[model samples]
Target: MSAFPAQPLYLVANGPLAGRVSVPGDKSISHRAIMFASLAVGESRIEGLLEGEDVLATVAAMRAMGADVARGGDGVWRVHGVGVGGLLQPQTALDMGNSGTSTRLLMGLVASHAITATFVGDASLSKRPMARVTDPLARVGASFTTAPGGRLPLTMHGACPAIPLEYVLPVASAQVKSAVLLAGLNTPGITRVIEPIPTRDHSERMLRGFGADLTVEESARGRVISIRGEAELKPQHIIVPGDPSSAAFWMVAASIVPGSDIVIANVLMNPTRTGLLTALRMMGASIDEIDRRDVGGEDVADLHVRHASLSGIEIPADLAPSMIDEYPVLFVAAAFASGRTVARGAHELRVKESDRIAAMAAALGACGVACTEHEDGLAIEGTDGDPIPGGATIATHLDHRIAMSMAVVGLHARAPVVIDDAAPIATSYPGFVAQAVLLGAEAR
Candidate 1:
């Protein structure tokens, strides 16, 4: 999706990694911060906002829709909102780049307004299904014209005084849930979503932070989440914590590399997003939580990780929703464990930037790690903490997680690991290479 030329990278066995570092801001929260700020009544200041390409797409879309968004030289981003039901029709189609989150959530926002806008994306994002979000929005009186198979490159027409509906999630997806809730922000009455399985609560937390009328109730069926329509939003100063997804690479890298000890600062400790930590600790990783505190509305802590001999464990299927994005790196971690690691209940990985399970299997196998690809997940055979044969160049499939995951493998491998293209890392973690190098990874 990036216009930059393919950038290949090589990583070899590095010495003991030791450093104290912080990753970029939470990508999920960063997207919401801009969206909510743009809908509030006054100026909202944001600190530690992620400036990655994906988040920038959200900013660009908001600006095109009449939100005054600007970044101060002092590193704080300020947004002047246009108020509820006040979005201006954009002059051009919204280019979402490779960010599915931006496209899906923005579609929800536009679905309840009186605006008609077209949404387009790069090749990778265009292949993803948009029907999941559009189906729920259509019940709210919005109409959509999408590519065959409900893919991207679509046009949506919003409904004024949109119909309020109660819908149940067929799957556990934060994106779909957020889209429906966002549409409810401007509808005429209460819109309700019954989530059979809980997903990330960033949208609900952020909506409440912006003073929207929202509530969650536990019932016999599931968690019933409701948002009142035509609500007024008030702006507030927000400080985003470091992304745990980004920190996962460091967590896995330090655990396997011999004698490696590093401290990752200000990582988000949201319960719904810490499955990787739980899985790694179950594998005998020495990760300690130090100085736990609250930042904005989420839990933040520094992770003190040290080298430990890891053993493969049967990862719980219920944990899939919490660490779905981190599975690629988790596979790399599993490769160094003492036995076989089995993962299932992650069919969602098939729809990410690439088929992560298949992509990781091929990449790891190319590096001489034994792996079996499954319809829904993967099973990897570990080298018992020994160096794996890694003299092969891996195809990244334009997936950032796969690129970074193999980079971790190279650190403990017998030979250098070559990435065909690392450019996709800029979508979320632009400083990934430099940050790894700072932690003693030999990269070029």
Candidate 2:
């Protein structure tokens, strides 16, 4: 979380984990906070913002586009926007680092303004599917010159007074949904998105909170979201909760490792992001929610989890969108369950920072766990609460989730699991190793 991480992390086989830990602010919400606040009319103050590299990329991009973004000594971020449709063309290319959320979301913001900007990213991000957003934005009059395969290192020419169109999401992706909606912030009239599957609703909620005219109507087809543009965005004070996605690693590690009990504090309990919790509960993990409250209009809770025997079952595909980012850790949990765990309807995993299914599958198999990878998901044969025979070095491919998930595997492995290039963990969970060590795990 400090700067670029150069040292590779080493997480060894450790004793039982106990006590409490709190992760950083929600990555998704942190990106949105800096973005939404930058687009509002007045100075917006955000508390508990995530300092991870991914979200920080959003902060830098917003600042590059002529927004005054600054962090105080007290750790709150303040942003003064040029209002909707007032963003200036950047003088240089926006370096998105390794964040898909920052790239896709900022692409939407730039698409509706009368500006020209270029987006570039790290190697992993350059291979991601940007067409999901670019394709929809093209219909709204934005023009793009992308790298081969519709990848990054692309330039975009924004369309002033862009045409409003109704878009239907072909996939369950929050980034795509948010990109379209963020573009609608400037275009005149109502822009609608018809989602066949519900993704996260953070953008819609924050848009409305910032005083944008956005409405949602649910029908059999899916959720119908309409946004009216050429509107003023009012600044707000936002208190972001802990990222549920980040909390997922500990949730799985505690539940699967023997004699482990831990409490994670101030976690975002939004229904959409709690899919991992629900799925774990269905798998028979002993997780309890306490200190329930509301923070910044989103549900917040403290999770107290104790180790329990888990039985694998068919993971409901509908929960995929909610727990998309948590799948790698969940797959680790599945590796130690009672029976075969089937995770289908998650083809999206193939396109993340790395092919998550393949990454986890290979890592689990390396650790002596039997896992079969499907095109869409994976089927893992659990050891049924047994320690895995580790002593394998996993290739993390510069992916934070892949590195952390395998680190969890190391906790209960008979031998130490050495992660290749654990530097990627700084992308999201910056202090992951320190926290793991604090929880009585041998992580470096």
Candidate 3:
């Protein structure tokens, strides 16, 4: 594993960017596809799977838990499941690398089984809060011995004859919700979760695809999801669509720099994950959806984007859950828009691999963009297509989103921007540099 040097990017003003590129598979779906396949009764095949470190961590953890998962020729992956309630203890600790998704989801999967497993990660992931999952899972009779403040490098003790209960999510988190549902798979009766705000619903959709009895209903407070316990999950093939989060970088780039036309193909159009697109549209970005189709229970479409003048608007806090992963790039887009863009209700951004809100604010400020930071969000004043003086070096803090977001800003900056570490980009989106270069972005 080689470390990526402190690469700086240079983008000259006024170049037409035109190309069609397909980003890697959806990170969320890729993680769930491997996990569900590993728990099914038969062999499961996956296509368009992300080979990023996050998804690979799930694959490795599944293999450690007694599943036969392997890569074949033609870029396909196969996983032989151990059936429900058949996970065997691993001989070593499960190293999740930099993936919070892998660490949190696997904790739920192993919580109700008859095994004890320790989870570890890189420095950034170890700092993220895990109490969201551990606190709720503990109510269902699972026990954990974690670091102070419920951080990682923790051990999960499974609850045999697991207790199934209805849990209400205090915050809008898909990981915490999914963790409970995964644990419910081995428990008896029904396990329910009430979400105040709708997060990404990949787990619910995928679990239903694997033949689990899962149901969603709207309530006065919010949405309620119920999963029946002790049910057999049928194995099925999954085709992962390109990640919209990864596509966000190109989308923002194509929107701001003049005379740029780029098409992103076969990207996931899940409503729960399209907040970035919606926010961009609200800013009058020249983006269109083309050749819509359905693939493996997900909506897929090609995004045709062209450069256009953008005007900023206030983004509602409720929309945060859908595009939480994309705020970094969204902030970059706001820096060049016409007015002040205010984003609220984003407390979740604080606990990601890095504090995304703070990171974006700091980076944007360093680059001569005026931004007002909030406890939960930020207010950014756009320059309305004027040249932004950039001459600042950004510390990515080993966060992939931070690195990519800064690169997007360089496309319109007065001077080139430098990021401390570009190495972390491989954790979720490999070939990021090549994809950006194909779209007329210069990276050195």
Best lDDT among the predictions, by candidate number: 1
Arrange candidates by lDDT, descending. 1, 2, 3
Q: For model 2, how does the per-residue alpha-carbon lDDT over 1-444 read when each residue is reduced to its tens digit?
A: 225554555675466789999999999999999999998988999999989899989988998998999999999888999899889989999999899999999999999999999999998999897899999999999999999999989999999999997998999989999999989999999999999888889999999999999999998889999999998999999999999999999999999888889999999999989999999999999999999999988999999999999999999999998999999999999988999999888889999999998888888899999989899999999999998999898888888999999989888888888887877788898889989888997765
On the 0 to 100 scale, the lDDT of residue 277 in model 2 is 96
Instruction: Compose the digit string of candidate 3's lDDT tens values, residues 1-444.
Output: 224455554444348778999999999999999999999999899999999999999999999999999999989899899987999998899999999999999999998898999999888998998998999888888899998889989998999879997998998999999999999999999999999888999999999999999999999978999999998989899999999999999999889888899999999999999999999999999999999999988999999999989888999787899999999999999999998989878899899989998999999999999999998888999999876889888988889999888888888888877877777899999898888887776676
Weakest ten-residue segment in model 1 by summed lDDT: 5-14
Q: What is the lDDT of residue 240 in candidate 2?
A: 91
Model number with the top TM-score:
1
Query: If the candidates were sorted by their TM-score against the true structure, best first, what order would they fall in?
Result: 1, 2, 3
Score candidate 2 by TM-score against the native.
Answer: 0.98
User: Residue 140's C-alpha lDDT in candidate 2?
Assistant: 94
RMSD of 1: 1.0
Query: Cα deviation of 362 in candidate 1 (Å)?
Result: 1.0
The whole-model C-alpha lDDT of candidate 2 against the native structure comes to 0.91
Worst 10 residues of 2 by lDDT: 1-10
TM-score for all predictions?
0.98, 0.98, 0.98
- The clash count of every prediction, one per candidate, is 0, 0, 0
